[model samples]
Target: MEKIHYRGFWRSLNQAWRGLHYVWKTEGHMQFHAFAGVLVLAGAWWFRLARWEWLLLFYAIGSVFLSEVLNTAVELVVDLVQPNFHPLAGMAKDVAAGAVLVTVIQAVIIGIGLFWLPMWRWIGG
Candidate 1:
């Protein structure tokens, strides 16, 4: 594993921001994700979930973004290589989309679980 140092934290932040910029630039889906993140973060704040719950939220957000980036890459490569539709190309695109679907579903479940307690308390459940 790569050793992490506080001294390089700013550099790490820059790298992550650049990745976010690329995603926002290339993928329309990322806009929706940014909106969703804001909404979920609001809930997370209200819920006051444990540190581990916040960790889970972060994990879900990162996982979805990673899957989205990969999906974008796959579509770009496949389109460049095979402009004409082919069976395997279709399959590749389908598989990439499937991955995004799976990731989004998982993230939704985690978000709901993370906010459930706060929601219940507010609802007097």
Candidate 2:
């Protein structure tokens, strides 16, 4: 195993940002998630979501984003270790992607549940 270095806090944050930048640049899924997140946030603002609702929405969105980043990391590491196509490597990537799909589905359900009544009331008014 390679030795790990302990970087300062600011350096750590910068490195994290760099990884996010790379994902944003290379991954279309990340871009779509970002756009969807923005739309959810906008809806929250428009509806004046309750504190609990805000927290739930944040958790859902954060989980999706976290899963996406982790999935990307898993894919990168798998590719690095196994440059050629392998069944196990493909399986690993598929599992990671499945995690992102699960989170996205959860987020969508949460969004619909929280927004449904408010949206209907707004429109009905």
Candidate 3:
């Protein structure tokens, strides 16, 4: 195998952006996560979340996005390797999706803990 030369930072950044664009374009779940993330940010801003709360929220959001991207990558690789209907390939895809579900569940728990009270107060008071 030929060794590839190390690209500069900008090229690397562009490649990363391209991967994100590919996921955003091809994956419906990613679009949903992006929309939900936007709503979370809007609510966080509206509530003027504390610094620690912001940190936790950011961590949760990042974890969910990271899990989604990794899940997409896994599914793509599985499909590429096993184009036909293979039980193992299907299991691999399901596991990848399960990872995303787990991440979303955790993030939802965190979001509720962080925002539930503030949202209730903001609406009721």
Candidate 4:
């Protein structure tokens, strides 16, 4: 295996941006997650969430984003290495997708917990 040379800080940042751009360009699910996250942010603003609530919301959103990015990385690496249909490769992709699903589910639950009371109060007034 060849050792990778360490690039400067700016170069590392550029590479990270490139990875994000590629994923955002190619993955519909990532776009959907981003859209949902935006909505969550808007909801938090409308509700005027407490500082702790805002922190939790941000954590939840970040978790989803991280999981989705990791899933994409796994899928890309698996495809590159395998390049052909194999049961194990399929399983790898499926598990990665499952991870994203779990993240989304938890995020949704956190959103509900944080918003339910505020939403009801706003609606009642």
Candidates' TM-scores?
0.81, 0.90, 0.88, 0.91
What are the Cα lDDT values of the candidates?
Answer: 0.88, 0.95, 0.92, 0.93
Model 2 clashes, total count:
0
Candidate 1, overall lDDT? 0.88
Q: Put down candidate 2 lDDT per residue, 48-106, tens digits, no spaces.
A: 99999999999999999999999999999999999999999999999999999999999
Segments of candidate 4 deviating more than 4 angstroms: 1-7
* Residue-level lDDT for 103 in candidate 4: 93
Best-performing candidate as measured by TM-score: 4
Candidate 4 differs from the real structure by a C-alpha RMSD in angstroms, to one decimal, of 4.2
Task: Flag clash pairs in model 2.
Answer: none
Q: What C-alpha RMSD separates each model from the true structure?
A: 4.7, 4.3, 3.8, 4.2
Which is better, 1 or 2, measured by TM-score?
2
**In angstroms, how far off is 83's CA in candidate 2?**
0.5
**Candidate 3 error regions (>4 Å):** 1-6
lDDT of 4 at 12: 90
What TM-score does prediction 4 earn?
0.91
Candidate order by TM-score, highest to lowest? 4, 2, 3, 1
Clashing pairs in 3: none
Tens digits of lDDT, candidate 4, 26-118: 899889989999999999999899999999999999999899889999999999999999999999999999999999999999999999999
